[model samples]
Target: MENMLQNINSLGLETSLTLDDIPNIDLYMDQVIQLFENNFNDSKRNQEDKILTKTMINNYAKGKLIFPIQNKKYSREHLILMSLIYQLKGALSINDIKVTLSDINQKIINDEIDLDSFYTSYLQLTGQNVIDLKKDMEERVKDVKKEISEAKEEDSGNLEQVLMISSLVHMSNLYRRVAEKLVDELVVDKEGKRQK
Candidate 1:
C-alpha cells in the first residue's frame, strides 16, 4: 500500500527529448522509426508496444501532421513535430492535433518563428508542469490517507489505492477536457479559420 502510494508521485517522470537529442541530418523512414523506439523506450505501456511505426508515420504524412517532407526523408523539424504529436496524442484527437499544428507549420515554413527556441521553451514548461503535477498528486495522496485514517470502509486496505487511482483519473480527465476546450477555442480549422 505504501509502495503504491509512493509510486504515484513518480507518475509524470517520463523524460523529454532535448533539442540535442534530435539529428540534424535527414532520416529515412526506418531511421525515424528506430530513433523514436530507442529514445522513448520507457514510454511504451506494454512489452509489445511500439512508439512509432512506418504505417503510422505514413498516415501522419498523408494527414499533413508532419508537413514539408523532402525526398522521402524527415528533417529535424519533422522529428520535433512528431515528438510533439506523440506527446499530445493521449489528450487530443488527430484532427485536433492537425488543427493545432496548422499554424505552427505555416509559421515554420514562413520562417516567422524560431522552432528551436519555441521547442526549448516548451520543454522547460513541460518539466515545470511535471514537477507541479507530482507535488499536487503527493498532496492529494497525503490528504486521502489522513481523511480515511479512521474510516471503517469495507476493503479498507485497498480503499486508499482505489481512491488514489480515482483521484488521478478524475484529475487527468478534467485536465484533458480543458486541453480539448482550449484547442477547440484557439486552434484554427483546416481552412485556417478559427471556430469560435
Candidate 2:
C-alpha cells in the first residue's frame, strides 16, 4: 500500500510536454497521433488504451470542437486544440469543452490573440498550476499519513485508504466546480451579446 501511494505521488513529475516540444509544422493524422501518444503517454491506464484516434479527431471536427483539417493535414492550431480537449475531456462534458473551445476560437478569429501566443500562455499558466497542485497533493499525502500514524491500531489501515480517496474526490470536485463556473461565464457572456 505504501509503495502504491509512493508511485501515485511520483506519477506526473515526469511526463509533461512543454510548448517547445510541439511541432510547428503541419502533420498527418498518424503523426499527430504519434505526437500525442509520445507526449501524453501517462494518460493511458493500460496497454490497449487509445489516447486519440482518427475517428475521434473526425468527431471533434464534426462536433466543431476543432477546426477542419486542411488538405488532409493538421496544423499546430489543431494540435493545440486537441491537446486542450484531451486535458479537459476527463473532467468536463463534451458540451462544456465545446463552449470553452468555442470561446477560444472566437478570440483567435477576432485576432484577440493568435494560436501560438495563446498556446504559449496556456502552457505557462497551466505548468505553474500543475506545480502548485503537485505540492498540494504532497502535503495532503503527508497529512493523511501523519493522521493515520496517530490513529488507533484497528482503524489506521482503513483510515489511510479512506483519507487518500477522500483527498482525490475533493480535488476532483474542486476542478469540476471551476470548470462549471468557467462554462457558466461563457454562457452568460454569450447571452449578454444576444440581448444587445
Candidate 3:
C-alpha cells in the first residue's frame, strides 16, 4: 500500500502567489493587470487565455466585487481582494463572491482587521488544503485498486484507469457541492435574494 502511494503521483495543487510576490507599493490599474498576467501565465489553459483585463477589473469595480481604488492605483489589499475574486469566480457566482468578500473588505477598509495577517492565514489554509487533497487522492486510488484486485494484470490496469477517473470526478463534485453549501449557509439572503 505504501509502495502504491509512493509510485502514484497526485495532481499538482499548490499553484498560487505568495504575499511576498505582490508589490508592497500601490500600483496603477495597468500595472496590476501586468502583475496578474505574469504571475498566472503558467496556469493559463491556452496562449490567448487572459489572466486579467481592464474591462474585467472595471466590471468588478462596477459590481462591487472589489473595494474602490485610490487615484487609479490599487493597494495591496485591493490586489488581495482581486486575487480572491479571480480564484473564486471559477467555482462561485460573481454575486456570491461579492457577498462573501464584502465583510472582509469592510474590515480591511475600516482598519478593523489586518488584511495582510488574514491573507497569510488564508495562504496557510490553502497550503494545508493542498496536502489534504493529495492525501485524499491517494486514498481514492487505493480504494479503486482494492475493488479490482481479483482481475488479471491487463484487465486490472484498464479497470483501474476507469475507476480512478470515476473516483476523481465524483470526489471533485462532492467537494464542489460542499463548498456551494458552505457559501449558501455563510451568506444570509437579504430580501430572500440568495446567490449561486
lDDT values of the candidates? 0.82, 0.80, 0.79
TM-score per candidate, in order?
Answer: 0.89, 0.86, 0.80
Q: Could you tell me which residue pairs clash in candidate 3?
A: none
Model 3: worst 10 consecutive residues (lDDT sum): 4-13
Tens digits of per-residue lDDT for model 3, 93-157: 88788878887877887889888888888889988987786687678877877888855456687
Ranking by lDDT: 1, 2, 3
For candidate 1, write residues 1-196 as lDDT tens digits.
Answer: 5665356444435566779989889999999999888888765667698989999899898998877789999988889899899898988899889878877888878879888999999999988887787677668878778767868675666898888788889888999999898788764344355333
**What clash pairs does model 1 have?**
none
Between prediction 1 and prediction 2, the one with superior lDDT is 1
After superposing all C-alphas onto the true structure, candidate 3 shows an RMSD in angstroms of 4.2
- For model 1, where is the 10-residue window of minimal lDDT? 187-196
Clashing pairs in 2: none
- Segments in model 3 whose C-alpha atoms lie over 4 Å from true places: 1-12, 149-159, 189-196
Count of backbone collisions in candidate 2: 0
Sorted by TM-score (best first), the order is 1, 2, 3
Model 2 residue runs over 4 Å out of place are: 1-9, 110-112, 146-155
TM-score, candidate number 2: 0.86
lDDT tens per residue, model 2, 1-196: 4555466555653455566777888999999899988887774677688888999898898999986678989887788899889888989988899988997776655667577777778778877876787667677878888877877557677788788889889889997998799898999999999999
